[model samples]
Target: MKNTSALFIIDDVIANQLLELDDEYIGYQVLHEESFYKHLLDVQEFPVIDEYSNKESHKALLVIRSWQEVREILKEVQKEKNINAWKRLFPCQLYADGAYGEDTIIQNLSCAERLLIRAVQEQKYVMFYC
Candidate 1:
């Protein structure tokens, strides 16, 4: 498995799941408004860019806005990365509050999958995800 460092700007639920999936993976959880702003500042400066990591390690930045927007963003990011098969190696979810809880989240994910497939077919990178 490729080891990667990922940055997630998500809610408590998604962040908890990600941590549970991999204890070794280091990341920050921005669940509050102040923390979110702080995270944006950090991203602009790119503090983690110089941090040490292995060649196989991958770094990702996940920003979870609203439930609807998060899915759109994820689809874009997946397209940009050209990722397929939904491998657990780089598992990260941008989750937010939707009407139907997990069901809505899953539906959103399906949309992201479709976008991913289209991106793969066209060999195009979605710019907003970056």
Candidate 2:
């Protein structure tokens, strides 16, 4: 899982279960290795992250204790100002190798926003696997 991150949005019950059991389980794959954290940092509303541990396995999990916190974070992510900040951070550019370019980062941000909106609407909690 080097240089990659995954976001899982699960039902509150499932989140509680995982927390209680101190284990990890697969859930709705919202973002997989999209590297949205940089963009989140640019927006200056990065969610607090905590470590989720089970035996030798450990992953960074977004510290969201309530749906209201999710909504608050979502609001910051959806703001035009924040979106523009991402745009400035990832200005469009071309690469001769045609690998993942600046546009990919922006696209990832947009996709994350959509999924997080859905999570808010569905009242789910998020866990970041890093």
Clashing pairs in 1: 3-57, 4-58
> Please, what are the lDDT tens digits per residue for candidate 2 over residues 19-65?
66443443323223243222222111111111112211333433334
In order, candidate lDDTs are 0.33, 0.40
- Please give the clash total of every predicted structure, in order: 2, 0
- For candidate 1, what's the RMSD? 15.5
lDDT at 28 for candidate 1? 37
- lDDT for position 24 in model 2: 42
Candidate 1 is scored at a TM of: 0.26
Residue-wise C-alpha lDDT for candidate 1, range 1-130, written one tens digit per residue: 1221222333444434434544443333322345333432111111121222232234334322333443454554543243332322223332211322444434444544554444344433321111
- The global Cα lDDT (0 to 1) of model 2 is 0.40
Clashing pairs in 2: none
Candidate 2 is scored at a TM of 0.41
